[model samples]
Target: MRRRLRVLVTGAAGLVGAEVTARLAAAGHEVTALVHRTPVLVGNDGTPLEAAGVRCLTADVTRPRLGLSEADHEALAGGIDRIVHCAAITDFGRPEEDYQRVNVDGTAHVLELARAGGADLVHVGTAYVCGERDGLILETELDEGQRLANAYEASKLRAETLVHKARADGVRSAVVRPSIVVGDEHTGVVRDYKNIYVVLKLTTEGKVRSIPGQYEARLDLVPVDYVADVITQVTERFDEAAGRTFHAVGAPLTLRDFSDVMAEYPSFQVPRFVPPTSFDLGRLPREERVYYERVVALYESYFRRRMAFDASNTAQLVARPAPGGGQDFLRRLIDHCLESGYLGAPLPGVADVLARLDLTGADVSGPAANDANGAGR
Candidate 1:
């Protein structure tokens, strides 16, 4: 019988990292979780992973050489056979160098650790690396003349490029690109703000009042569990995926449908979605109009277009799905948001929505502390 494998995971405290930790431990692998610091308590849904039979260690990717002492590095190298990297800062609003620091340089640091341990590397990358791709984004296509939307995409592309560079240098590496990460379909458990969740927060806060485009953009979301499952499968079945890139994405949802679904609460009004020509420039104060203009510009680029994902390679290799949910189910997810007080209050009109579906994010959205304010009620 094959002996249990020793695996090292960076960013084990993150959404993908935490789920990956649970899955790996459940699979009977000896898992070592790497993190930068010990928070008061990891939001169970937070970045630091929690699971049975896993050893948690301290390590920061952004530091020089991963911020580890020689002894700690040797201790990790002594038993680790594979390395999974999922600890990138996906904030689109950050500067270029910041993204490069975590996404590019941090990846290089992880590769260095993998080399030290003679372990195969699994690199977590973003599907947005496709960069303004319009349709049918394939798995094997990397340099397909796609332009990056922001620093986040550009830095991810650079990081993936570095992975390939390491492979050329005789390092075994696998690249996993997940698109527009959402809450777990089965659990609705996402730990932090990234991807489409930010839109919900900003919109619900009334920061994004009006959109000057058709609410017809495609927002492709993949669940954390599916991503974790696929990552584990790829690690176990590394040979089939070595030197390959995978696109783990779902079918896209239009912008109008997305907003409507997230606004199941009557208190949370659906903002007006107007065509550019229909926007009344004279109605808003000049500064407010400029703010709206910025919102319009940002959303127009990202959440406003139709995008197709061709996951044929990932499909053939991992043989799993990207957890599909239409706007109706998404409304029920909003019901969890209200009940959990993540939105600051309960939804007045969500009794019907709550009755029809299960809400999983309630546990995921509440704060990590055993305190009351963490989750709302």
Candidate 2:
């Protein structure tokens, strides 16, 4: 028989967090949800989490030590047996300092909560923490000190450091790194509007005139549900799983192929996957280079990286393989987002108030437009 567990989940309203929390609840584990703000969306029951047997607590994750009042901290520490940390800034373009504060320092604070509760910690990290373009990114391997393309990776690396240190301090911790998470394979419901969705929307909005290549650059994407499933399954084996990291990535799918599926949407055209050297940057005027950078920065950042995410640990531990990858998966994802009205959804009225225009670019592939630090994980 298994012990009934009390689990606290950070980033409870996030895409992955929502799914994982729901799964955990379904398994009869008590779940405590920590949200950054007023929690509107609830679990699968279409009501408040408390109604679903979850204790919902609201706090800013970026606060020093999570800004928890004594009552809140004691409330968190008293009954929690495990913590699933899904909070972190995922946007690659956020200022390095901001990323460090949230992804790195924020993780330490979450660890503190877990420590106070004597709970095993499960942290959701990204596979890109493997760092800039190189060779195989192994699941069990880490901290080769790989060069980072942006701040997001750097901060996550710092966060991973914090979690590992906690493990060393007897926190009984484990980390999961997912690469390019997409929508559900069966349902095609994706709330994330960044990453590939940005590119697809731009194409439909006519931001891109030419793809410049056959879109053949190999890309990787994994389904979110699959990741949630793996997280749930792995957390159950905490004693052996502690201190381990697993990569939730699918088999390699090329960018061109990704676009082919995405282009099925009215806005996106099949990408041109010409070799990077095939296009001469010098031919463009100074301003065009800047403009081109805005238009293609996201694509460039991802396509420029050349490596495979090897998830042997994920496969071995979860007994599942990445589902619905490559071209078909991409098209289905784009279609779902478009039909769901997520792509190019009107910014909320307060976007002007909260909008960080300094971080946005005119091009679709530019930095994130909303709050998500990055796309799926």
Candidate 3:
């Protein structure tokens, strides 16, 4: 039998954090969900955490002692067995200072809390911390002297460095670095539609005509549920995962594969991929250029380089298989977006068009479709 541990999770309002909280609760673990502004501890389907017997606390990771009062700090210090530090600003457009304040400084504060509580730390970082380096990225690799794409990457790298330093100081720790997290594999339901969805939305809405990218560059995307599951497993088996790093990523899709999936939608404009070095943003019309500068410019590095993450450690630890990739999964995601009105209302007769194209399947839509694989809610 497994021990029922009292776990504290930070950033429980965000997508990955919320899912991790829910999964831990479902696994019969005592969970204390820490949030900043929003105190409502509800899952994606509006299920309250209290119903699952999970405790919710209002706190700030950027503050000393995580903004906990003397009584609360003593309680946590006495009872909390593990700390899952998932709180960090993930936006790319945020200023460098914001990234430093949240990702870097906030991490240090969390480390102090773990030190006080004598709790094992499970730090959630990003695979992009490897930065602009090419070839395979190992779980043990950090600070390869590679150029970062943005401040977000640089800040995450610094935060992971702090975790490593803490490990050396005798704080039992494990780091899980996930790539671009997307919707659930079976349900295709996502709390937020940012990152890759930004490009898909612009293209599907016919807002962008051309993009600067390499055709062969691969986009590493993983499902949020898979990431949460991996984290939970690591936390449960901390004795084995301590002082190690795991990559929670799956098979990546190339730019060509992405374009091919978009091509299936008749109304979607498949942007012509131009060499990043030769592509000029000034050549675009005013509206497109403005949108590119505001929304797409921050992710320019992702389209230009291909970075592969080696998840050998994660594979060895996780019993379940990783989520599937390729065009089939991409199609399911687009169909879910259209059905949920996330990508806006579907065009007239879009279902008929898909039927005529022979793209219909049992995994296309509805709750039954989502429940087929028992993967996600």
Candidate 4:
């Protein structure tokens, strides 16, 4: 018995935003998808949002009144009953001011729009706001004076603070923090591969072979669909969501599992893990040092942490459990990457390689024969 709501989804063109928009529209909610540059939104399954009765509006969240005409703003404010604030610059290593302007200030403007419309607000934040702290992270926790890992996390923390204050001031607001979002849980398909995918691409290519990490360190990866479903449920059941925080996260996979899964793929180069304290950039070759400094270093924090997020609050409200994650899930992600040609075609299997060799002239003791036999083994 969910009442149909007029929903305005900011960052509608983004990874999570796109899925959320599609789900809202499919669930019969009146959805207005706000985009800054890319007005066209394609769902993870390649379904176009425009065909689902979703109105795509070009608006900038960083601007006052969402960069809309005063009249248009008023009209939109009067029309929508819910605002799902999903817009933010998620790129790591960006200038601090870039995060400040987009993640922090943009939220302020969204808050204004929510207030003007007397709408319930659901703010999409990140679980990493728990910062560099290890062990269990509860939805109830926010600022524990924890040292943040990057500017992106810091900016999200500030934005979440704004939402909490707004809720206290009587604007019905809730926060949903999702851990690392990947592709569809079932299909392993994604709109765009960024974040951890970048690291995977580099590592699997043998560009950065050694990483500062621990085998037992955990990485929590959630599917985009699960994140979207939770948001949709929160919107449909605002009463249960208001004043609460939920962690939309899957089961964590240990670094050992990640390495083991990659090993299973013959085409993938399994990266060697070393203790962070013992690792030094100065000792690496010039080319490796440059790659590490520019790309790998940004995600180095994720490699060493062993934090686990508590999702009890999310379990109570969500209809289904978060997707299971481990070695198999990691394999699925890599398999999809290979299938989509993102990671390039996988190396030829042992049978294919053997069939291509002419046994009559093939020197069994030579480098080529030895290499092929080693690969098959």
lDDT of 1 at 274: 64
TM-score of each: 0.81, 0.81, 0.89, 0.90
Give the count of colliding residue pairs in each prediction: 6, 20, 0, 0
lDDT of 2 by residue, 1-377 (tens): 66667888888887788888888887888888788985754532234444366767788778865888888787778788888998877654556788877888889888888888788899999998887757787877678867777778878888988888787677888889988777777666776666666656655543343344434445677788888888887777777677788887766676656655555555443434445656654443333344356656645657756688887777778866667546666666766776777664544432233355544344323233221211111
Q: Which prediction has more favorable lDDT, 1 or 2?
A: 1
The segments of candidate 1 whose C-alpha lies over 4 angstroms from its true place after superposition are 1-3, 39-50, 259-265, 275-300, 344-377
Candidate 3 or 1, higher TM-score: 3
Worst 10 residues of 2 by lDDT: 368-377
lDDT of each: 0.71, 0.70, 0.83, 0.86
- The model with the greater TM-score, 2 or 3, is 3
lDDT of 4 by residue, 1-377 (tens): 77888999999999899999988998888899999999789888676766566899999988999899999999999999999999999878888999998999999999999888899999999999998999999999999999998999999999999998887667898889999999888878877889889888877876567889899988999989999999989888889888999999988999899888888877778777888887866666554566688888988898889999999889999897778967677777777888888885546533356668844344322222212111222
Model 2 local distance difference test score:
0.70
TM-score of model 4 relative to the true fold?
A: 0.90
Among all candidates shown, the one with the greatest TM-score: 4
Ranking 2 against 4 by lDDT, winner: 4
Off by over 4 Å in 3: 45-50, 344-377
